[model samples]
Target: MGGCVSVSSRSTCSSRSNGERISPSCLWIDMFRRKRSRRTFSDHVTTLQHLSSIPSRIFTNGRSSSACIFTQQGRKGINQDAMIVWEDFMAEDVTFCGVFDGHGPYGHLVARKVRDTLPLKLSSFFDSFGSKQNGSGANCCNGNMKSDVADPVKETSTEDRVESLWREAFLKSYKAMDKELRSHPNLDCFCSGSTAVTVIKQGSNLFMGNIGDSRAILGSKDSNDSMVAIQLTVDLKPDLPREAERIKRCKGRVFALQDEPEVQRVWLPFDDAPGLAMARAFGDFCLKEYGVISIPEFSHRVLSDQDKFVVLASDGVWDVLSNEEVVEIVSSAPTRSSAARILVESAAREWKAKYPTSKMDDCAVVCLFLDGKMDSESDYEEQGFSSATLQSNHSGNVVESDDGQNSEPCLQRNFTVRSSEENDQYRRVPIDADVEDAENGGTEDQNWSGLEGVTRVNSLVQLPRFSEERPRP
Candidate 1:
């Protein structure tokens, strides 16, 4: 005796087996709810899949929507340079870029390891501290700099806070990275190490961290609307005054070799093994005990409308091309995607023409455009001449002399020169006169064994330990 019950003017339902009434409207609503639940579940799965793919966004050697990266192997056995540009690094609108230059037998491995893991560590630190605005996180990041009188929390500006947060992140990440290298089971970092030049761009703010000799520079427009090259990171060579002081204080020796007087290197106290060209780097455990640290120099900058782009590169590029030359080459590029490749090619040609007899060092570059655009038409017309012609014109401007006197552009002047009187202050490991003569007098056809730019030995030889008591000679 079941009969249909009309719930509304447009819908009705029949009685069920239990003699209860049901409305078609209710049934439709229930079905719609179930369908929506399924749809929501599917959306969540899709979101998780996208989140898992974030690592794929890190480009090692390619062009991205906002950046371009390129690397070239040298005559050296293997390419030891590594670089990356990660978009949406930690949060939306943030980007991270880095260039690593490895030196020593296992330098390539060390560089790649840092290139992959460092940014992750930084992101982790940033996230861990981001939640606690006024808690132990802030205090720990600030170290012992908390003011006793004025409230630092209230006195800090927006720029200061951002800089402080990133500064802590860089410091901790670099220290942790070096520690990991020291304890890594598979990697041998005893005498091997890598240089790092990294930058994080969040909106209009830029934070940079650097160690060793790799460099970062900005290409910006001046008041006259002319392109200008601004160096961001100092090359942390062993010859820098503060760097030399720290190494000497830690019982590490710093001096130039007989052949390359202009290049100063860090050496061991008891033995002349593993002469590292830079004052700071990741790995090189032997030198680590002798004041070679892995601490990065941090800097911050607020981007301006005049700012054009940034270029991060290994020492290989810097050794041959000047900062202005690099900026000119990049600005004149026909397209943003081709800028890094063109710059690397220009550096390669310069290396061949500048130091033909020397083995070229590995080159890596990352070019980041700030405004997300390049004036291809203007650049093409401005640089109508070929790269070779531009290079020839640049080379003809000034000649480098033996006395280090050059009318060359002020920025291109070499600063590694140390007077003989200055050299007398440091204890130098003596080299056999015969060996020195052989190296200097060697023929061009002779195969070079050591690294070219830094003059690194192939392997570190362990010398015999001398006894406290001297026997008759």
Candidate 2:
């Protein structure tokens, strides 16, 4: 009973004074296993903690001291619109805001992916450009390795340097985003694409990068002390003289349908399919070779006290509401948090009154208030409005899905039809010939025959013969 118990050839446990003995080897092994297990559990918990902290910084629908964002699905299929406001985006003083409107099938996914990734790419490029500028006074431009301004003395003013840095970052990030979309394993972006209007606010300076029809407008008080809408980014439509010329030069057709005489769209040379309403977008590789570029139009604005707020919205809201009207609606909101929701509801109402038959397009809005001050109740009264007037009846339409994603409660529909200035442009066409006939002024009996099935269409009528050669930069 007093003998040592050998648990292993090399180790043993001495007997206690009573009668039993225990193996120290076994106890040591147990303690080591417990420590290793605890370490593994601690690592998992830290990973989960890091993940949980992320959603707080990236907000989809919420209000901050300087910003508020909201989005609603249209009658069209899924909500293809995605939005984000990343507070403290890269630094404590900087914030990133963006709204992406997806088009064609899988447009929602494309929009979401772009919303999540484009900002990261921009941040990376911005940092890289900063490092390069700090180390060697070199600048990147249009894939060129040499600096555009070779003379060091020409690089005058901090504003000019900042603008140059942001411009290069915007261009490189957009190009990288498009390339990533083309090769993405989970995404089929050959026909689907998204319109992006992104803004980075650092101190008093605002850096914007925009492509496609989605718009960013600034609300500022004019000399008259009245609010005015200053459009920051141009709506890059196919009908723009330069845009149309480029498309035509690339053998891409730019024309308006007989039914919608005003809505000029970009079409393929061989087929009457995938009529894109905008001149630029991310993805839509089918049209990339046809002069549809992803290069964003970059702009920088220094904010003043008179600059009230900035509204970045999808074309859906812009299509139905005028810029002035949107400004008025936002300014009239009872609270800053309710501004975006009210604007979207107003757009929805206008859609019903303006185009009774056409499906409402998805609307996403981000309102970034320049000043942190909230409007007093007296401000609403001065505008001759009440809080009740700005409230939206369809506010509850946006519900959290089982996947923890916010989506409108609606049955899945076919492809989407992009409409602008009261003209409908089909992004993807249905397989039905009757629908084609209807679109081409078919018999009166065929009117609205395939309109219900109208959702986002494949941007291609038929897949064109792709060349084996590498794509141009």
Q: Name the top TM-score candidate.
A: 2
Across residues 1-473, which tens digit of lDDT does each residue of candidate 2 receive? 00111122222232334744433212112211211122254663454345314643443555555676778878767777887787766665578999998877667778877877787778767776665444322212212334222232332233466677788999999999999899989787877899999999875668899988788889999999999988777677775666778899999999866655455678888888678878899998888888899998787776777889999998888776778888999998877767987898898898787667677878899998876554555653353334422223244444433222444423242344444543453323332222222123432121111122232332423344467999789
lDDT of 2: 0.67
Candidate 2 lDDT for residue 21:
44
The per-prediction CA RMSD against the true structure, in angstroms, equals 20.7, 21.0
Q: lDDT of each structure?
A: 0.65, 0.67
Which pairs clash inside model 2?
274-459, 415-455, 415-456, 416-455, 416-456, 428-457, 428-458
Report the C-alpha lDDT of model 1 over 169-281, residue by residue, as the tens digit. 89999999999999989777887789999999776667899998888899999999999998777777776666778999999998866655656688899878766788999
**What is the number of residue pairs that collide in model 2?**
7
TM-scores, each model vs. reference: 0.67, 0.70
Where is model 1 more than 4 Å wrong at Cα?
1-56, 134-156, 374-473
Clashes of each: 0, 7
